[model samples]
Target: MVELSGKSDPFQHSFPNAVFYIPALIVVSAVAFFGYKLYKSLTEKDRKREEKLKAKQAKKKK
Candidate 1:
């Protein structure tokens, strides 16, 4: 491995802002996706419960 001279440190390289923004964007997207999935699951359970109640009420009227 070639060593960089006196003032030049390998770790001192400048990274563009996009490098940092990319990971942040990915994390935000993943969180949003998971949140949506959880919301949909809860709503589905509620819908099923409502259907059962409606069916039971209809049977009582017969």
Candidate 2:
């Protein structure tokens, strides 16, 4: 015959879940910040390039 302990499952008492979530949250936050910065910089460059091309075209018509 086997007997079960009255205590809860062993996993419930193990290391806290925050140990994994905290580092993962930090990494994800860093990636998002850098990704947004890169996106803004690329878009700004494209906008400036487009404006220069338009100005050149307008000058040719005058």
**In candidate 2, which residue ranges exceed 4 Å CA deviation?**
1-13
* Residue-pair clashes, model 2: 0
TM-scores, each model vs. reference: 0.78, 0.71
Question: Please, what are the lDDT tens digits per residue for candidate 1 over residues 16-37?
Answer: 7787788999999999999999
- Candidate 2 has an lDDT of 0.84
Listed per model in order, the count of residue pairs whose N, CA or C atoms clash below 3 Å is 0, 0
For each of the candidates, the C-alpha root-mean-square deviation to the true structure, in angstroms, is: 5.6, 7.0
lDDT string, candidate 2, 9-31, tens digits: 66334456787788999999999
Q: List the residue pairs that clash in candidate 1.
A: none
Off by over 4 Å in 1: 1-12
Q: With candidate 2 superimposed using the best TM-score fit, by how many Å does residue 6's alpha carbon deviate from the native?
A: 17
